[model samples]
Target: MTRDKNKKKPPAVQQEKLNPRELNTEENKHSNHPLLDTASAEIKKYLHDLIEEFKDVLLIQVRQDIKKLIKEMTSPAQENTDGRTEEIRKEREASEEEFKHNLEYMKQIQREYQETQNSIEYWQNALTETKDNLLKLEERFRAYERERKSLLKITRNQKEAILKLEDDKKIHNLRIKNVSEEAGTSKNEIQKIFTEILKQNFPRIAKRNDIQIKEAYRTPATYNQNRSTPRHIIIEIPEIHQKNRILKAARERMQVTYNGKSIKITADLSTQTLKSRREWGEIFQVLKEKNMQPKFIYPSKLSLKINEEIRYFQDKEELWEFVATNPTLQRALKDITEKERKRYQDYSYSGREASVNGADHGMRE
Candidate 1:
């Protein structure tokens, strides 16, 4: 390793210079390659010959391309291919200029088309947004209408229920007929008269001190006028047991006289209910004749035991139809029809005939 490190170096020999002529003398304006002159000269000669061989062919092809471009730009025309050499050259030059002008025109047309397309897109987007909004509004309006209809139905049902409850309260009231109304008589006067009538007719009930009168009033004079008129008064009793006893006794006895007048006691009903019962007058008579004991049940239902099976009627027409089919009902109905006809005739002769035009609805409760 010490011998290697101390090794003396010999003097280096110089490289011989080359003659430029031996390198095949040639040079370009850039003067890049020296030894590559021969290959470059051959490449240049080959390219020159290739160009010379295809010069007319290239020029003809270019001229045809320019003429074709012009033909595409303009309307259909006759071609003048067989022309003088000078005329063809001049036509080609004019064609080139026209092609340049058409290219510029096409570029301008492309820009205008792009602008039109952008405007159309903007309006389309706005119209789509508006359509969506309108659809949403329509949906909301339909929902609101549905909700309104639902609310109206609920409100109508609630009103009917309230009216039914009001009518039900009339069940506790009692009406006294042929109880004369005195002139300038107030509630106290009417009560005194009512108490005396009750005491005379229903003795056992009147003696009970526990039975309290909630209200007492004289009937409206118009209702008890003209057809063997009975002056009426209304009484409200709170005790169900006492009221039932009085009502039951009155129904059984069928007649009560007070102050030399034939007084009758009856249940006080709502106007609608009384009208409904009055319509069943003939039906009630039929039921009575048949010993059916048809009664006004809760909510104004007509109930009776038919062949041991309890049947109910809400409509008079249904009762009439049922009677039409049953022999017993048919016979009973005939009697009532004859009675109505006879009553109608008597009224025709009397000239002061009383006809029920509307329902009598006044009650104490």
Candidate 2:
């Protein structure tokens, strides 16, 4: 193209793009200043392009970092929410299990309480029944006590009447003891043997043969060869006066004999009367030793000259009471009274027995 002088002419380097590195070469250093301007412009353009590229790269990196930071922050919050939900679910499950266990425990307590109530009711019913039975037993026992007392009174009265009838059958009898028994002896021969005894012992009596014998016989007993003593004979006198006379004569002699053998003559009384007479022997001896002039009145009555008066005692209690009034008798019989008191307490015999003995003691030969 033709150069246009009227306008400003462009540089030759400026007509083409230039490398900034080419301007620094030795060849270009010698070239025109316009080339430097072109190089500077190219350098500026390259710097601007580099700056834009770096900015784009930095912006992309910053965007990626922001997304990563936002992901980091948001992911942790979601995880925390998930973990909290799981923990809440587990807590709720544990609470439900605990509640179930508590409910079962409360049910067991209710069952035990019901059983306790049932047991208490059973014991209360049993106690009420036992109390009722005890009341019934007490009532029955009182009734039995009254009946027993009534029966005791009736038994005591019946016993007294029986003893009195037994003594009346033995009133007018005389017995001989230790008479030698001869074999083949008859009742008539027994009578003759007694007649001879009266004749031999009572020869001084006026008309001793006039003492009539109602009957005479050996007492009923089985004969034994080993017997040490002979059996006794009974002499029943028809007249009471004659019996008394024979007794008086026999007592004065103090010794009666038959066929050169000693024998005894005594009133034949009931066993009860004999026992009663034997009991009076101790008191009789005591009174006789004291010079009281004691004597037997009848079956068992003791007649003692106490203070110049005769006193009758029905029992040991009566005698003990009588002795209490007299100092000399009490002192003399203190040991005997103590022994009798001990025996009385031990035997515990009712006064009815002594009264019965007293009622029956009036019979005598």
Give the whole-model CA lDDT for all candidates, comma-separated: 0.66, 0.69
Total residue pair clashes for candidate 1: 0
lDDT for model 2: 0.69
Residue lDDT tens for model 2, 1-365: 12223333333443445466764563456666665667668777767765675676689899999999999999989899999999999999999999999999999999999999999999999999999988987765454444433443455344323434554444456888988887224678987787778777777553445766677777665677888878878778777777777778788899999877888888776676677677777777878888988876555556778778877764454576577788978876765666767765554345444434443353221
lDDT of 1 by residue, 1-365 (tens): 45446544432324235356643343333257543555567667767766775677789899999988988765343333334556889989999999999999999999999999999999999999999999987875565445444544454456446646766686677887776554224677777776777688778767875667888776674544464654567778887667777878988878887876788887777776677678677777678778887887754668876667677876554465476687765665676666665654564334221211111111111
Each prediction's TM-score against the native?
0.43, 0.49
What's the lDDT for residue 148 in model 2? 39
TM-score of candidate 2 on Cα atoms, chains taken together? 0.49
Clashes of 2: 0
Off by over 4 Å in 2: 1-167, 183-185, 335-341, 348-365
The CA lDDT at 43 in model 2 is 72
Residue pairs of candidate 2 with colliding backbone atoms: none
Clash numbers, per candidate: 0, 0
